[model samples]
Target: MNRNALIAAMIMALLGGFLLFAYLKKFEEEASGGAPVKLLVARKHIEPGTVVTDDMLATRVVPAAYVETRAVREAEKARVVGLRLATPVQAQQTLLWTDLAITADDKRDLSSLVQPGMRAVGVRAANDDKSFALMRPGDRVDVIATFPIEGSTQRQSIVLLQNVMVLAVGLDTTAIDTSKQGGSPSSQDLLLNLSLTLPEAQLLSLAAEKGRISVALRNPDDVRITDSLADLNSNLLTDSKTRKTVQDFRKTPTGPVKLPSAAGAQ
Candidate 1:
């Protein structure tokens, strides 16, 4: 071979070796950087329809090259639904190109006890002097019936329903806007809808036949924990001091005896 050609071949081999060495070094630097990213989770388990929040991010592990402040920020906004609780996640859960937050309001009324097949009556009454001033929907109440029983000398006030839900207070269950109505509605008129059981409906009907029925507001903390009739009667009896008073009054009568006057008087 010519001397010039041999020299040129040796130079080309040297340049190729240097380029290969540089490429291998660069690959090694990337491999040794850090642990692969592991996606962090918010809660151990979540139900369906739950919105993802910022607190549910996994930040400890990430790809060495992909780990950047911008990437982390973008990932914080990502939301995923299939994340079962306690499942290990990866960088795939992160949001890379979207700006959004997952959220929803799930408030519900816990007072309504009306169920299918249950017999209920709709009752209405006034709260304040104005019909609009009274009770609101979702409020709990005790229904009292004042009636005279057959052969009884006096009237009795009995509780017909306990922990009853007030489904509405006026003509509307929500609210009535007088301005939208073009004129003010009567203030003294109010209406209420209530749920009742079969026996309760019978009792209410019988009592209503004899006298007036009214509703007594109950404490908000009072909850219907039991449906035991005996317990209810016991509670009602305990609350009534009138029965004891009446028994005592009957035992002692105020009058004068006239047996001796019949024998001695002219």
Candidate 2:
């Protein structure tokens, strides 16, 4: 072969080798799961309607191919931290955009929803009461105050306000919950915002500070107000066994025992 032709053949062989090497490397990357991406996941099981915070979140790098299209990424972590989840996410599970509560996208002022004669206030829903976190916007609730009555040995449980509208639950404004998210309750308080009159707000403030407040969920269609409602006290305990237990406890008052939540923590 001619000298020029021999050099040309050598050059072509080197070029082909380079291209083949590059192709193999690319194929291997794809087979292994492609490039790593920073995906945001729940550090612990997160309950529905619970507001997310930085401590509850974690970032992991996984193969790009394994990630869900709707999964929240590290860049979006800031936005998700302060928002509520519409559904529950398991520990180490990927957080998706679809997991966000309806209120997560709400940027409007809550003041706009408050009428001139009404006020909006937030109440902390007990972690034990899953119903309060499940309440939705526009749902009716009856606020009940349980506190020690003046000059009485027993506490009085009376209805403070009836047929009050639930403005928001955990700031979600959705009464719905995801069955999948059921698990140990989040450490974060399930915040509930209610719409109330000025007088009712004052009453709630006073009652909430004085004693524990509980909300009774009401049927939206049933707006009939009950009159002459009697307050509940120790006298109402008709069950002999239960009454004995209460009386025994009251005599040497030890608060209720703390136990693990119904939904066991993972």
Candidate 3:
């Protein structure tokens, strides 16, 4: 064949092969629902009310035909990053918009925000204690507990929990709504929702029932956990130097406060 003729024949053969491949691919996809589409999925089991973060999410390849509108698409994955989850999701399960804690759909339940394997604990503070009022969601604080000791009539103040995160202030995790500005916090609602492990929650519950617990506000950037802490017991409460020591201690890590000795108490 001439050069022009040969080139035209080769082009036609190549075009035919490409068309056949495309047809087969389309048929396969049709049989299997549709083309693979990107979807957002849980990398691990995520608890409800827990703030969604980058690490907890993963992309999944799902058939386009099977994807629901509620499921988050890969194109919109960034939308969920800073939002909280409204419902618990198992590992590898698809994430839906309904699962997110947004607007009126957001559940008032604190359990949704508790991290997987962790527990939500509400630690009561004294009404006049202004520390908890200053604590917002995501702020970390150390918990201090004051209780009467067996040997002493004076109450002992000891550091209970360290570097703990505040989940919510009186069931309102975000902050005081702009609409609620005119309203004042009621005396009966002194509960602060705190994220804690099972054991920590148990300890805190007992402390709230038996003694008084207080929130020691923490700086968002500071994460240092003090290795050595001197309990502020009878001797320190009476000592004049303790005033300075207590002031210094207030700036440290914050957490759920409970009496460590509660289990053995009479």
Candidate 4:
């Protein structure tokens, strides 16, 4: 072979080797970077405030580059199982930390929802009050107490607390637990959790212990403070002709004077 042809052949061989080495390096980098990572995704449409369950989640293999920092991994399914969702997540969408209603540490205790310096007091629901069954977290309510008067057999219903924020409806802060009954009699009882001030909590605790406690649902937009001192009495509905006359007796100079009692005598 000619010297020039031999030299060109050697150069072409070296060039080809260099291109092969570059191609191999690029393939190696792609192989190293394109690994699949497992991410937790919602198996079905999960509404906000719905409790996450194992069946509602599925593992999805996605490119590592697409995995977000806040994305929950398949291994974290156990931790997310009982947690609530703060926002709705579509089916097959990746579950993220921000999508959760509460943090992992705060899921067990809903005190985080209570305003700072407020108390979370749970009052027992009256079996007859079906409104408790419809309540949800973040709802507003009026706490009503029904118990007999100190010396009378007549039951009196009073508004013990007003415009109270409902921290939870049932034991599980996320779900409506109609099965959990808990009144004075087990069958008639359900728990209604509320957020109140210290004094309001004390009042509610006493009311719950002394009488049957019931909650009246309020409109979320209706935060109007009710200063009503009126107490409801069943006698108001009874026929006036058959109702017994109540008199307010007071001491007087001549003798004890009597006057007609108010509609509801406190």
In angstroms, how far off is 23's CA in candidate 1? Answer: 71
Structural similarity to truth (TM-score) of each candidate: 0.37, 0.47, 0.52, 0.46
Clashing pairs in model 1, backbone N/Cα/C closer than 3 A: 37-61, 37-62, 38-61, 40-58, 123-192, 124-191, 124-192, 131-187
| Highest TM-score model number | 3
Which tens-of-lDDT digit does each residue in 163-246 have in candidate 1?
Answer: 776654544333222234445445423556665667777877777677767886665556543233221222235556745754
- The TM-score between candidate 4 and the true structure equals 0.46
Q: What are the runs in model 4 whose C-alpha is more than 4 Å off?
A: 1-108, 127-130, 175-189, 239-266
RMSD of 3: 18.5
The residue ranges of model 2 lying beyond 4 angstroms of the native Cα positions read 1-103, 174-189, 238-266
Q: What's the best-to-worst order under TM-score?
A: 3, 2, 4, 1
Residues 1-266, candidate 3: write the lDDT tens digits: 59999999999999999999999999999999887889999999999889999999899998876664346778877777999886799999999766777663443456656645677777776767645555556678888787898766877777788878777777565533323455556543466777788998888777777688887777666767876677777776567887777676655444323436877687
Candidate 4 lDDT over residue span 1-266, tens digit each: 69999999999999999999999987875776555789999989999999999899999997664554446788777878888888899999999765787642454456645545677887766557565656766677877898988777678889888777776656545533434455432322356778788988888888888888877788666766645356867665574642332221124322233668999997
Residue 68's lDDT in candidate 4: 47
Residue 109 of candidate 2: its Cα lDDT?
Answer: 48
